[model samples]
Target chain A: MLSINDIHVQVDDKPILNGITLTVNPGEVHAIMGPNGSGKSTLSNVLAGRPGYQVTAGSIRYQGQDLLTMKPEERARAGLFLAFQYPVEIPGVSNIYLLKAALNALRKSRGQTEVDAMDFLALVKSKIKTVNLDESFLYRGINEGFSGGEKKRNEILQMAILEPLLCILDETDSGLDIDALKQVADGVNALRTPERSFILVTHYQRLLDYVQPDQVHVLAGGRIVRTGGPELALELEAKGYGWIEHLPRETGP
Target chain B: MNHSLTLDTRLHDRIPHLPGHRLDWMNQFRQERLAAFTTTDPGGKQDKQWHLSAAAAADATDPPHLDPAWLERYRLPDVFSLVWVDGVFCPHYCVREGLPAGVCLKSLDELSDAELTELRPDLTQPGLQEADALMNWNLAWLQSGAFLRIPERVHLEKPVQLLCITTAPVGLVSLRHVIRLGRNSRATLIHTQTGQAGASGTTGETTAIWLEQAAVLAHYSLQTQPATARHFARLDVATDTGACFHQHHLALGAARALTDIQIRAADQVSCELNGLFYADGNRQTAIYTRVQQAGSQGITRETYRGIATDKAHGVFEGLLQLQPGVRKITATLQNRNLLLSPQAQIDSRPQLEINAEDVQCSHGVTVGQLDEDAVFFLVSRGLSEAEARTLLSFAFANEIIGKIPLTACRDQARQAFLAALPQADIHQDWL
Candidate 1:
């Protein structure tokens, strides 16, 4: 199981993740839905150990190990992957290199041999067919000048390649269209396993139809204010966070 | 400082020994090198280390020499080689055969009296004050010359290698070379001068070379001298109408190496120049380059890359001049430098002089360390800091090194670059 225990996180001197606690067992997907300014993205970033997010007080445990103690890469090596909200455009470094380097780093951590050029190319070709990305993107600098949808799809491609145990996807469906969203969802679904868990951070219930999370949580004022089964996403999508805003301030954060 | 820099005495001695023409223009040129040498205040330009006599004083160590025994290890495979070792030509070797018909490749000693006469006067053309000093200094100490002349429309299959081997026995070792590729001719020369393997604390080496008319030449000069060796070389090229010229100067090592490369194009000519300078340890290297468009419709692009660490200092000064009436000229110059250590310093200057409004010219210069965001991104992606920085630096140099047409030279540049990085410092934080 992956769990965040009363995490208190701040960014640039402002509190964002205010003592928020959430959990997900193996084979369970939890959708974190929130209003625009309610710190939905902050929760995802804090969980992934993104730089600049100060975790003042919190204990995040994954598979019974202290998650916060690990460096971002070490956490990643320990099977924690975060699909970033804004994928950086790295010029002159081909996507092929990024994928291979990431895979080999993880392989090294696992006490396995690194993939050679030929085998790595073969692996990427097979995965490329799934995302429907052209071979040219493989040669282009990583995410450099890629379209918004293409960038999001690239994140999904990285998720597919690394295959982490606990995946925290931050707003992965924001810029994705119906077709791209479906492809991305299909790719994520293809990697579903009883030993893996996912924490999907999205503001809409639209993606939940394809991803089908086991639980849904509402984060308001940097705290989880509401929790329910998968149907909570549809209810919140239909009614919106306006109803929650009218609730008592003492209820969260 | 006000003394006229005259090379008359040096030219008088060299002209009689050189093989060139007896034209009146030749005499004018001989007088010019002398006048420029005598009249110009070569010492007043106290800017970068181009002042030959200035650098010698600042450096306390004995300058480089021409130790033949030490030069044996620095030889390039399967190419004709020549050198003015310690200002003296030693064990000279030249291939007079298998050259393309109308092709001429020989040392200054091997040159016939007639051919030597033709190159003598232009060797010190007018407006070449500092240039004349460079040639005069070489003439004063010249032991031999590796001269290559390609006749009109001749194209050679293999490149010619000119190796100037220098060792630090006395003070400074200076040299000169003239590679003239004729009308519609195409050739490439890999001119490399290395320090004698086992030398004193440090040494300085200066060399000057030129290429002329409708000649398609790819001039490559590389220096991997020790961090204790100081090298200074000025490469000045004046191309004729419709000539195409390209040069790649690489200085990965050299305790102190100051290189200046200037390419002036005749009307309708084009040139592409690129350089890579890297220094580790306390090594210091400086580069100054200018591309002057003389004729109309000329084009040029200049790029310089430097990666420095461990108190290493690098300086890059570039000038792109599009003279009046040289309309429709397109020029671009860029100098990008990277500093690895906190003490590593780089002073880069990229300039543009456009007298013609119709010309399209632009220049840019940047001196910075590896991008922090890029470094963190690579590290977060599980790359060691050393691996990440080296990869980034190599990527910065790829555009320049990738263009090297020769397979072997390009490979050497990449290998040397990767090997110059610090291994101990990168893994410090990994644990």
Candidate 2:
């Protein structure tokens, strides 16, 4: 139940996304395919409520709430998760510690019981195994000196632990090798269900092979110029965004 | 009442029973300094290097008045409490039988003539140059008292505590503290400085203090000066061969303070210095240290770290000087700081002066704000920014806290450090 209605975004006072609209209902996956500088990451950052972004005009409603009004932390506590393209490294803060604090913060906000140290260790260790990350990774400063693959796996590990209602994967497939990409895609696919929705942001059609989207929208010039079923990804892979110029731009959300 | 105080170089009235020829080196050193005190200003125009700017207006004679109306109103450690009122010992307020045998816990002022003479062979030598404040300023108008000798080859496994309560609300208060720990002797001294709230609940006054050659002294210097206080303390420790000096500086509530601490290691002696300071509010602290390796085959290491919040400023300047022919000397200084506020400042300067090529030396300095990537990485997992920063501080403290060597003391200090923080940031899962 995530909706983006005429979302126009600007970063550093320059408009990056002119006017974009997308909606993900329950049980469906939507992928936004675009070339570099196509406002893919900007859209995700705007939805996540990163600062220094001007909406100018338009509103995004997530599960029937004014999403723009909430802080990045508030959005997170409300079950909005954004798996960053580049996970940050926090020296001196271990991965496990950050995960537990976040999990507890969200759980506390929801009036739910939080997990203790023993349960958290037991829980995250299993999640680490899924991401193919060693337990030592959890002991390190958050992303401090971690390899590119390890950072992505850490993002997936966090997603597994938080279990958000809606997750926005912003270019998570970038810089990931084939095997790592498969593992990440598998992690995303494993979490998909009728109750949860995902907005998969990527440029390639290969990830779509493992994570078949219910709808594939070809984004160009800050707007979705073409929309079609999963087959559209395979067709566009054969063609490219260069051919999207011939397609008619969608008029409405 | 006006108090006329001067740097009285004559701390002792030429003792009659003193050893005439023995300890000639100490006698000659003091004579030379005493002769030059009038003409040569060893401590020239006051500079920020000594952090004595607050004392520019007040000459050595103008001592900050000592009155107990303030300190007597506050809560403090009740063990062997002693109050130093404007270069005078109030009294040893409490005497605990809990002290171990062979431990002579007496303030310099309280020492009898015989006891003073026994220690005078070294104690009366001279004051320290760590700040260039003359011995007369300290001994002449000495405000803070002392924790004296623990005899040779004795182990006082228990602790001997000394609390120096500064009650003077204004002006300068000179402190002369001399601790002489004998050969193969061991003892723990808890030296604390406490301040009180202002007359209208604002805060107390700043203080100028120093601690002299605490040879073989295991000290814990804890300061809780008031928020409205700006103070400077230089703790100089000169140790002999086969001696150990384990010192820690814990600063909790002081607006602005600096502890210029130095330790000299004679050959075959072992020493470790662990200094911790938290600069919150507009609090600023600069720690400048110089460890001179005058003797061969010695070892020393120091870890200095602090957290700067609000508009606070934190500094660490560590210098290791290895004299010529002083080989096999091992030394390392690690300085780390966390800047919470965007405006907070952290500066680190680690220096090494090596005369011998066969010595080992390592130094590191780091100053960084709360890690943004770390915050995002943790937040993506579910932690708030606050949780992320708090956890980062924990990890930083652990790396240094582990180097404390003493288990019980380390644990106690860790608890105090944690209680002052926002929260337990590093989750048990991370460990």
Candidate 3:
């Protein structure tokens, strides 16, 4: 469903991702593991069309369309989602209000009718259970004073509501506890479908324990150095990223 | 060659026909105020922030017919309303029925000699003396305004709504309001000022509020004049022992608008002031607030937010003073602003003068553009860039509008702000 061919990314005239390429088919989950400064979050941000990340040389194809040419909102309407590493705290916009507006905007782009208020509330109430948040949370400002775990779960709640095709979760499990990690993993697992694809960008293998990935890619020095099956996460966990940093870069697809 | 002299001459020519001109005491007061206004130097000419033009004042004739639909938009539901059209009270539009006992709501001209004599102290209180030009001008040309009074131990159930509408195309509308809450009394007042399209003159309003011992007063002032209009408003409040005062001021319209608020708190008094100002286009809106804590154990909190887009300019100056011997006083002042365009500008000054020992006072000021990360977050959720911007701007202003205690008043303030916001297509329900 998505293809990145030898993409070189830079931020502020400094090269971060050098000739990195990856591919994901429909219904597949790719766990991108990396240490500090490995460009894991940068990759996810670039995939979601975040500004300030210039793709110097590469091409990204999503569902047969040029992904690089689409604006951030256009990419989002076309089913691209990125769960930020650190979610922003918007003080005045209520969580539910933003969710409703976002859902309506997505639906409008797909030429669908706006959801009725009652139906929208019902949907939100049902989806909110998956993230284990109270109904009162919907009335508060978006992550205004939310805890780290709550912000992560709120992101999952939004993902559950929007139901995007390709979800890129950037460090969603960093600050979460064991229970919140399980809840988030369960939410992601429940949303898995044949038409959906996922990119789980993380720094540790703990999140992979609950939600197993189909492919595990060890990213070091801005390029994938190793690729293996789900057992690869356990291998990396057994032997830390120190060993992976010395491995030769993989030249395979 | 002097602008104040020219304005004085023009006003002098119009005084003979002004309201209350024949009343001996009222005429004497007007003459004194006019003299003070003419003699005051009106400093700060070198201050770029003082952009008020002397030519904004003009002579007022009879106003044009006001549209009922326009008036209805600002009318709050289930309240006793007193409507003023072109600085004159309109009895046909005023809702005077069902007023509770011991509550007096009347036009200044309608007050009997006894009532006027009783209210003289509050009317002649020393507040906003530094703004001699505007204050004295308001008194000299005081057309007509409302006087609200609640007796001791009386609690008003329904809020009183004061609606002032300006329909004159080019004229000055000067109004003076006196609100007195007796000992242990409680009341809420919603004061709204709006002008019809093409009402391109100046509207000056001065309101003085006196709260006796243990009295509580909640005041909401919303000014949404025409884009061509110029508005100057001053609010003075004094609280006795244990009295509480809460005020929300929203300045959302006019080409040049300035609001000055001064408050004094006695022993153990509590005061809260919250405000929001939105200025777009070439509009200039300024809010200056000063709170003086003169008694022990007084608590004061002031929060203000401003939004300026296009080439609009916004200014917020908050001053908190704790007098000597006022122990255990707590005060906080915060001003946050948002500039939406490169050309848009905002000046926020939060000053504190602490003289008493064991007093805690803190002030914070921030002037910044909208959080770009927040904007990106909203945009990545599928909203267009414009929609995201409008929503964020609305949210920034809502931080202040959401603090209004009354639901109806909050909704009215929200609608007014939304209407003033640029590129605002987002629905209120969506927010």
Residue lDDT tens for model 1, B290-348: 77887888889888888788888888888787777778888888788888789988888
Question: Each model's RMSD to truth, in Å?
Answer: 5.3, 7.1, 1.9
Ranking 1 against 3 by DockQ, winner: 3
CAPRI class of candidate 2: acceptable
Select the stronger candidate by lDDT from 2 and 3: 3
Clashing pairs in 2: A88-B373, A89-B374, A90-B374, A102-B382, A102-B383, B87-B142, B87-B143, B198-B203, B391-B425, B391-B426
A176 Cα displacement, candidate 1 (Å):
3.7
Against the true structure, candidate 1 reaches a TM-score of 0.83
For lDDT, the strongest prediction is: 3
Per-residue lDDT of candidate 2, residues B1-431 (tens digit): 21111222232333122222234543454454334433334332223433333323132233334444555433233344455543345553445566656666655556654655576534544423432443333333332356556667776666655555544445455555666676677677766665554411111121222222333556776666666655556566666776777777777655667676666777777778888777777777767777888887878888888788888888788888999888888888888787888888888888988889788999888887766655554554555667756766766665565555555555545655665576654434234
TM-score of 2: 0.71
Error of 1 at A169 (Å): 2.6
Q: Model 2 residue A199 lDDT?
A: 88
Model 3 TM = 0.97
Candidate 1 per-residue C-alpha lDDT over A35-122 given as tens digits, one digit per residue, 9 for 90 to 100: 9988988887666666788889979898888888877677777887878777877664577777877888889988999787678778
Worst 10 residues of 1 chain A by lDDT: A244-253
